[model samples]
Target chain A: MDRFEYAEARLSSGESFLIREKGVNLYDGNEKTSFEGGEVVLTSHRLLWARPGDIPRGLTCLSLPLRYVVFVEEETGSTSFGFSRSKKIVLHLSQALPGKIPGPVNRSSHHYMKLSFKEGLNSNFVQIINETIQSKKWENFSPAATPSQASDVKLRAGIVGIERGIQEKQKAADESISRAFQDLSKLMGMAKDMVNLSKNISQKIRERQGDITEDETVRFKSYLLSLGIDDPVTRTDFRSENKYYIELARQLADILEEPITDVGGMMALTDVYCRVNRARGLELLSPEDLIQACHMLEKLNLPLRLRQFDSGVKVLQLHSHSDVNVVKNTALALEDQGSLTAEELAQMLGISVLLAKERLMTTEKYGKACRDESIEGLRFYPNQFLQRED
Target chain B: MAEVEWPWQYSFPPFFTIQVHNETRTKQIAAWRSLILDYHKITKHCILDTREAQRTALFNNTAIDRKLPLEGIVTILEDLARTGNAQPLDKQKHRWQIYWHTLEEWADLVYSWVQRCGMMNTVCTLYEITDGDNSADEEFHGLDTEIMVKILQTLEVSKKAELFDDNQGVKFF
Candidate 1:
């Protein structure tokens, strides 16, 4: 657009990065431009668009001053196919100012530009951009002219005015909280925004105070809750069972990969069920459906697999955690200790006694070790039977 | 009898339980068999009562407060019987005749002793062969009479000796 200018990617002293969206296409009015699938970054004073790797390398990029924008509105349209839809944010602009640096285009015919989101528009980005624009902290270019300082100037007139400001802010927070919880549908509609808001709050607090809480369990719980799946695969979404399970399996593998790695590459099926359901939130998956999806993981050549123990306890484990590796490791441990009980192995390996017992049993099953059962509990030793001479 | 020196496995608590694993159980049974034979050879005890074996030093490890249960004792005894180291005396298997040496082995020992003492072609009573001073230093000196008769009968089958008059006497020829 004519309003755009070519500038260095670095932010000015008083400006701060607000939000960024990838896979955005810059549209000049109704016509498309060569700037397709680039990253759009919003700052306190400007919106910058750069090719994927340009900004990181400090290359020249297109920057539009926020002062030139009159208003913004969302535009949704059905493509010609009628099956797929596209979303865009249209920014209306005023007349171009004088003395602007030349950009990708020297002149443009339109007074508006559109950012077509290749991925669906993230509502949180729109909300943040609106707030940044309304704050008008750009009006004063001084480095000390923060929104908090500006608000302090207004409320510092007297003690009563400061008290009234604090009361108004608290009342606004209370109103939003009550409004969000007024109905299930309303809460559901705002769940994504609320989660993003909470995450931002926690991030800021952690940056200032090191951590949000001292309790490890609560911290872990919050961490788990934050790993939410944006779009969970539902059975009703697909016509075929095979397709549904395949998609679900793919999604599950993606979500569980990090967690499984964190907890030693193996997790009980029951535990996995809980974690997946927790991440799914209102989209609760049945145990049967989860097992069905897991069965497809291996067929799909995923890195995860389902294994059942001799005692009928099922678990999900990384393919790297094969039985051969477990048995070999157990054999090595048995040789080192001469003999070991499940409890002792559990202590040594820092795993649950049940999993340790399972490992020992697996070794025994593979003929890598033998067990001694007694009142003290089952113990395993490196198999000397086959190797010993009569 | 001097105190029998037990093997290290005797002190292991899990040695009391009959292992569930097949390979482990086989090894465990072999250990038990050797222990039983060695104990009998040292203490010169010939019989094993299944009900009372649990209380004995052979089956019970008092130091560890562990004892071979009846089922485990039976399993080991059955294994020993299968290997010709022991024989059940009753249909219920509650009573067992433990032979530190097989009947054929015992026959060989007795025949060698008879030849060494120049008792060949000479008749000797079964009691004298077991309790007489001539065999005092022999490993089979306190052999049970029933087992002695069985050993002599084994010799008779080989024509090295003969049992006569209700197995009370044996002639070596």
Candidate 2:
């Protein structure tokens, strides 16, 4: 009755078919022209020949069983289905998965079958297609449970399908990434061991053993980084000019911010150098860079500073009174806003206990700040000095 | 001697110490020496020298009764000798003139007092100022001989007055 059913009964596994279709056709190489009953049919399980044909409205499942084809030719235009009969599975790229519409492909032999790609196909391109397929729920089949096993790892593809020559390059790229990750994994493992090692070193130091090595401090610092200990030092590549100085100042502010009030708001320059360098990803900073940064911060007049007290203890002191912005903010925060404990403020600022303490101490010394004590630790109140006694 | 509180001058610490700092020391010593002259003349007092004064009761830190140490007193005087308010009467004696009021100031005060008492046109002996009934009668009371002579010498030089030896004693006219 129709042009399709006439060829359907006559079609067999050996029969050739013609599909006049124009679009991207995934190929795995082998292609051949076959003559049957005065019809020109191209048999290409591997190669896809795009010819002018009806537009593909939906996906068609064209699966040749695993017993059919012989040698597969993995050429550029190959359709990924060269050795159809091989135990190897053929991945199809047709209309997106989960589209309900049937395939638009028709053989010149007039035989047609709704086409479908292999189940559980998960190439990145297939994913876009499958997401559409699953979203549409195209074919009626039991939903497969778990599809992606490697969602955690993500790396960008180096090259799109340039040709067969470049396809091996993609393979090379994958191998390189795997190698890099293996190296990274080894480093991460060593860092983990050091985390445990540093604890022992701390114990040994307490026991008054021979002093830890000069490098051990750096090693201990490395161990701390591994343990997720965030130090406040930041280092930049040494720059030749003044903007470098500005950058150093900005970075120094961020780094010295928490350490300012650590030792009663004062510390020796040497002690700060050791501690700051230790915390700062173990980066070596020249004294010149540090001094330059300090001078810049002095210029900025930040609440924080490099100060030498009368006792000759050089330390970073955060001046709460000097922090006009912080005082203004805390004033607002404590206005109708209630008093906050150190922990509470740390939580609010998403900072560590050290930073919270420094900020609070600075605020208190500014004299507009006071304290509230409870079962909880000390918290600062707004300068009650601002208000007239009722 | 009984300690006295001053109306305008108070004992501040650096008032005694030799300020090692240049500009500030000069200013500090000046102030202390001036304060010393004023305080001493008003109290009409004497201070022990530094080395010996250390043993005397001073600067007790008693939470009351402010006092100055002998070293502090010496330093204050040294500052004065350096400046010219008072001299080391004898460096060995460590004695000093307490010029709370300068000679000019004292001359003016004495002249005013004598004129008030209507003694201006009259001659008076140095002894009259210390011992005589009328002289001992007022606040312009005691006059040490040396200081009296110095004052008269100062006055005579200016031709404002004259000094003479009389049967009564050395007199100022």
Candidate 3:
């Protein structure tokens, strides 16, 4: 506990939040401490613990710098009945340095601490913490160094110095970019890390500003790209065809539900193929496999379904968009207006004219509406034959 | 006589286009049939020429800039002929003899008129029955001679009238 200093419950410059776990109890070596049911936040530079809501409220909290952590390991124990008890993470600590800030304990008998997770431990949390510690990010933040260091001081003055500095920065950026792309294998090796780095950079920018870009298309693209499917299901992952397709279908539903809704409840199968492949990154999904998975969507009772139009154009549509509902809505629109053309309906519904025509054709097929073909174009009207006696 | 009152559908643009849908086309043809009969009956028109019909007000709506295509006109006229409301005058079907009333109905109307006038056994020239002063107020006034001959032939077959040579006149029995 003496290793923990009373620090403000906020991140310092160059520090970023990594992971957080709730219902954690701090242990002073083998003995339990007063800190129970507190939240533990693991940042790039420190691990902070506070009462449930203290960190969010920006109150003072206990902080332990990553520099003090020698290593960490999981302490697992099973009861006599073979039931696992609460999991814990043991952090081996070095000696408290001299002139350190005051803490809950003046001196400690133990040189290590344990964090007990009342809820089961998340393997991901431990993995991320180990990665953060290995990165040694805390070593880069020297407390004694000022923001404007002597190394950054300009030995030369005037526009020449500014130009030289800009050139140097550009040269460094060029060298790093070239090095990253020097070999295909090297780039492949770093692709996962690059993706994580890019995500972190964007998150940091978003934290400082409202968005990374003002252009809506770029923002939307980033949003779609951000919805990545980690560890996409592949055929090799399962031995049986049925199991493979079912798993693939579930993953597709999870990734595509929001995007399909945004696109007005329907998307062409080709467009879906493109989006799924992009989200899966290098694991390109074949068209046949996509169709097979889509077929299983309904068998699994998912929220989406595969539909083929009369023209043989296949699309993925939400279950809520049944033909009966579409026909009913189209008939209402036709009745509201005396009549409608495909172009006019497209304008009213904010959809493509081709889709509007398809909708009208569906309504006509159901006998809810009729069409008039003329030089002006084909128009649709509510079916009056069923309505009128004459 | 007052001008003919057109149906509301006459002004609708799509009415000029033959609908592709079966139900819609059925109703469209029915409407066209009635409109044609009413228009011809009011105007006392006995013959319809397919080539000349395009310019007529019945087939063309200048107000809406919509004209029934030649094929659409033929389709409606064929539908009428199928139901005994019209007869193609030529093998090419270019000219049609429109009967607002069927020949049997016309025969009945002429026979009743003769009986009401106490001319049951009198010889009546075709023109006198169609254009003479005595029949001026009649529904068949100034009827086309060709159609009048057909109507008289129907009456002759029923023994209600006897037609003279060359269809010049007829004698009521």
Candidate 4:
């Protein structure tokens, strides 16, 4: 029979099922009852069945599985099983037996029994449970009155409790994961609403129209901060100052220092400026400061610079230009005959004015181009000297 | 407008500030130069009236409600001048002699270019400096008539060329 063919079949005292073949007959256990034929039944965590041929009246069947069944050959077995008073149960098959099995509540003397079968074994494991009825109460496993009955009962209760505890823990973890997923759905909805509000806000800022509310500004800033994306937006996270953060997370901490909807989250530079200073808020970080920071963090991230507008306009310089030496060098060459304006650079690099300026600064730092003050506006000339002179 | 892909959208304070770092400033100037050049290059026009470039939104686009003030334009012009690439035409006219090439560099390149064009011994007119059926060096693009005269005058003293004035403005003879 397939090992678990009778998994659903109940294993009662009277029930029996056909075994395709008897692989082994193990009748050595702590119990004194002995058996030799092929057929058997496991009524509970332990198996049991009527001994074939021998009549012990209502003596019921015999069996054992789950627990490690030591094959006690005689007084001499594996050296490790040495006990002056106790008989030896050779541990060879014991060693081959699977890991810890829930020990049964029992006792007995000399008759050798095999506690060999294991749980969840798809093979001969079901000779009893699959082919016969099972008593949920583990009837056949009841302890025969023994001198040490109290100690055995205590051990049994402890073992069962441990299994119960494990099941409860697993259930709790599964519940938390499911709840977190539900919260994730809610977070997505909030993000959409935030984006809409940001668009409206950005529009207002461009128009120089209306008084923005404190709450509104903070909300928008908080949203931008939320995009800190633990994955480094700029390579700055790997620099000396940020090594710690990089180890724990792939993101930069500065990115997460969002505009505080609260005073604390608000920095002397950001949250407060958005709430109080307004337009001239860029004063919080002047070009010198920005450039200094960029220079400081240059090795940290490749593309970093102090940017300028093509119209020679001074826009805020906040973005990172971690790496662009090659681009900057090319910009220098292009500056040869006709100089490129901020607009042209922006067009060429496919970056915003802010980004173009930042990159241009990186180029400047390398002496790529020089600035021109003409009616047309600040323009970049390929640093002819750097290239030609070099 | 040469679309400057701003690495970032500058929305905060000083979107009005044009940084002075040469490389960055130069790029900024070049971008403006392109815009100015394209404006004139496409319009085949001369003289960017401050009013038009600033007020008309034809040239000066107040992308963020903030128009490039005359100062902003002047600031860019100043940077270009500092880089020896361009100069101003005037206040209201806000015209720039965009040195797609620097005057000094242009002067030197012009001499060499003239030599290359087989005009080293020959005297070319002022108009010939920029406007002509010639593949001139870029340093001469939008070369101001007056500034060319000045450059040529210096060369004249150096015995590089001789000049003559005519109704067609000035001529290098």
Return the TM-score for each candidate structure.
Answer: 0.57, 0.39, 0.56, 0.26
- Every candidate's DockQ is 0.18, 0.01, 0.20, 0.05
C-alpha DockQ for predicted model 3 = 0.20
Better of 1 and 2 by TM-score: 1
> Which ten residues in a row are the worst by lDDT in model 1 chain B?
B12-21
Best model per TM-score: 1
Q: In candidate 3, which residue ranges exceed 4 Å CA deviation?
A: A1-227, A238-244, A366-368, A382-390
Provide the overall lDDT of each model, using Cα atoms, as 2-decimal numbers: 0.82, 0.47, 0.84, 0.45
Chain B TM-scores of the candidates: 0.95, 0.64, 0.96, 0.57
Tens digit of per-residue lDDT, candidate 2, span B1-173 = 44644322133322223333344444544555655555565566544345544343332223323345455577666666554455567757466665555566667666666667777657777777556777665544675566666666777777656777643343334
Per-residue lDDT of candidate 4, residues A1-390 (tens digit) = 000111222444533333422322343343322333333444434344333432224343333442323332332335436433322222212221212222222333333344322121224443343333323333344445211244344332465557756767899999999999899878767855765565676667546534777677667656654543312222343466445323322121243223321211112222322432232221123334333443443345422223333445332223342245445444654555356666776677554554556556556566665555445566666554334421
DockQ, candidate 4, vs. native dimer:
0.05
Candidate 2: C-alpha lDDT: 0.47
Order of candidate numbers by DockQ, starting with the best: 3, 1, 4, 2
**Residue-wise lDDT of candidate 2 within A1-390, one digit each (tens)?**
011111221233333333322223322322222211111112222112222231132222233321122222212324545544211222333322221212233322312211222232223432332333333321222233211222223324433223433666889999999999999888868865665576666667556545767676667656655644342333444446566766667776666666665433444467666765665543456777777777777777665677653335455656652455655555566554556666776677665555456566555555545554323446565544334232
**Model 2, TM vs. native:** 0.39
The per-prediction i-RMS, to one decimal, reads 3.0, 16.8, 2.5, 9.4
Off by over 4 Å in 2: A1-248, A261-268, A298-303, A307-314, A319-390, B1-43, B46-85, B90-93, B112-124, B164-173
Displacement of residue B58 (Cα, Å) in model 1 is 1.7
- Every candidate's TM-score, chain A alone: 0.43, 0.25, 0.42, 0.28
What lDDT would candidate 1 get against the real structure?
A: 0.82
